[model samples]
Target: MIIEGTVLRGPEFDPVEGRVVVEDGAITAIEEESVDSSDIVVPAFVNAHTHIGDSIAKEAGAGLSLDELVAPPDGLKHRLLRAASREEKVEAMRRSIRMMERTGTASFLEFREGGVEGVYALREAAEGLDVDPVILGRETVEAMEAADGFGASGARDGEFSRERNATAREGKIFGIHAGERDPTDINPALDLDPDFLVHVVHPEPLHLDRIEDSEIPVAVCPRSNLVTGVGVPPIRDLHERTTVALGTDNVMLNSPSMFREMEFAAKLADVSARDVLAMATRNGAQIAGLDCGVLAEGRPGKLLVLDGDSDNLAGAQDVVRAVVRRAGAGDVSDVVL
Candidate 1:
């Protein structure tokens, strides 16, 4: 398959008029040449963090506190999940997964609720869909062993030493939520030596230093934080210290759309469009150990093609900036996942 367009090539996302040659689902070569196509080609997104299990709870708690909305056992989201049948939960998740695929997301890293059953439910949701899911089970060691990894709620919530150690023993990924509501949980979450930390919305000076020294990657969800009444993450500071990725977080709060996440991050922080694009793409892939997200030779041929001639994107001056700060699902021409 030959996808010709204004290809956003490599990690830099340097626009080049060319055609990407794909052979057996791997990008074989990127031949630079003038193409008569006005489509914009870029890497398919890898959402680094999400709680898609709450798809059944979209906009449920409109004015609830952060904890009241989603702090586990007694949270409204949890309550709704408990009330809904397994079939209802699966259908809702499936719809979200389909929406993600349609909007050019290649994969997502999910912090699934409901233990082992939760992992299997998400699998059922994603079955037969081109979009991939990296499910990190919550609550139990058995759940971690069943899924790809373990996703901890936070250090302030409980001691995840056992869960962390179990994931390590099984050589699976272990991630935790930290510094979202306050700086109190940052140190303890970092102490677990997790593979990644989600929502560093309140990183202190020492926390930043420790992150730089440890080189831990962070998944920032600016929209989710804002919706939950937490302050926006210092995206520039986190990017400066370590690898930073973008995530839509709870489906209850926001749509699982990389375009929206990228745009929000670019405008919220003083970072470049290219940096935000990387956060929406390759940075998240790195967090989940996926080979996709970069448009380069030998990489997986997961690409998003947008109609450059669309009314929403026509005559754009800067390709990268336009994609990051402006493009929407309506502008997408095709998603080759």
Candidate 2:
């Protein structure tokens, strides 16, 4: 496969007029030359954190507090999920997955609920789709064993050493939520030595030091925090300390669109457009141990092709900034997954 366009090349996303050669789904080479196409080629997005199981509950609990909306077992989202039939849940999840694929997301790290069955349900929903899901099963060790990893609710919820140890023993990933509502649980969550953490919106000074020392990667979901009335995460600080990735947490709270996530992240943080784009793509891929986020030699040929001449993106002086802060799903011409 040969994809021609203005390729966003390498980690820096340098714009190069080129044609990318793909062999057996891996990028073989990028031949820089003038191409007669007004398409913008970029790495397909990797959403670092998501609770796609809540797809059935989109916009259900408006104006609810953070805990009232999604604080586990008794939250409104849980209630809605419990009320919905398994078939309904599966169908909803499938639609979300398809939307992701159409909008140029190649993969996502899903913090799936409903145990082992939840993992299998998501698999069923994604049956023939190109979008890959790195599912972290919640609730039980068996669920983690059945999926790619374990996703704990938070350190304040329970003692996760057993589950964390079990995941480590099985060579699977272990992740947890921390510092979303406050700084109290950050220490305990960090204590588990998780592979990654989600929603560190309130990391204190000592917590930041610990995170830096541990070198644990963090996946920030700023939109979800804002939706739930929690403060926005210290994205700039987190990025400076560790490998910070971006996620659009909870389909109920926000649309699962990387374009929207990137736009919000770019505007919310003082980081550069290139840095924000990397967080939405490569950093998340690194967190999930995927290798398709950067458009470089030997990497997977997962790419997003956008129409640079589209009404929304035309006349932009900076391609990276336009993609990060202005481009939308309508600008997408093709998703070469």
Candidate 3:
């Protein structure tokens, strides 16, 4: 297969008029040449973090506090999950997956609830879809063994040393939430030596120093924070310290659209468009241990093709800026995942 366009090549996403040649689903070469297509070819998005199991409960708990919305057992999201039938949950999750594929996401890191059954349910929902869900099961050690890794709710919610150590022993990923509502749990979460941390919206100077020293990657969900009324993450500071990726968080709080995530992250944080694009693409791929985030030789041929001549993106002066700050799903022509 050969895809020709204004290719966003390499880690820097430099715009090059070229064609990417794929053989057996692997990119063989990116040859520079002028082509007639106005399609914008870039690496398909890797959504770093999500709780897509709540797809059945979008916009259900308006004006609820962060804890009231998604904390644990009695939170609105959990209540809705309990009420919905397994079939309903599966269908809802399927729709969310299809929406993600249509919007140019190739892969996602899902924090699945409901234990081992939850991991299986997501698998059923994703059947036959090209989009990959790297599921990290919550609530049990067996759940972690059943899925890709373990996704702890938060450090303050419980002690995850056992889960963390178990996941590490199994050579699977272990991620935890921290510094979302406050700075209280940041130290504990960091002390657990998780593979990554999510939602560091309130990192102190010492925490930042620790992150820099430890070189831990972080996944930020800015839109979800705004919806929950938590302050925005210190994205700029975190970016300077370690690998920072972007995620859409819970389906109840926000749509899993990488375009929207990139736009919000770029505008809300003091980061360049190129850096934000990296967050949506390579950075997330690194966190999820996927090899398909950059449009480079020998990588997986998971690519997105957008109509640069579309009404929304025509005549843009900067390709990367247009993609990061302005492009939407309407401009997407094809997703080769």
TM of each candidate vs. truth: 0.99, 0.99, 0.99
**Candidate 3: lDDT of 60?**
89
- Clash count list over all predictions: 0, 0, 0
Candidate 3 residue spans exceeding 4 A from truth: none
Please tell me which model should have the higher lDDT, number 2 or number 3: 3
The most accurate candidate by lDDT is 1
- Give the whole-model CA lDDT for all candidates, comma-separated: 0.95, 0.93, 0.94
Tens digits of per-residue lDDT, candidate 3, 1-337, equal: 9888899999999999989998998999999999998889989999999999999998889988999999898999999999999999999999999999998899999999999999999999999999999999999999999999999999888999999999999999999999999999999999999889999999999999999999999999999999999999999999999999999999998999999999999999899999999999999999988998899999999999999999999999999999999999999998888
Candidate 1 wrongly placed segments (more than 4 Å): none
Candidate number that wins on lDDT, 1 or 3: 1
Candidate 3 lands at a TM-score of 0.99
The C-alpha stretches of model 2 lying farther than 4 A from their native spots are none
Local accuracy of candidate 1 as per-residue lDDT tens digits, 117-196: 99999999999999999999999999999999999999998999999999999999999999999999999999999999
Q: Judged by lDDT against the true structure, how good is candidate 3?
A: 0.94
Sort by lDDT, best first.
1, 3, 2
Residue 253 in candidate 2, Cα distance off native in Å: 0.8
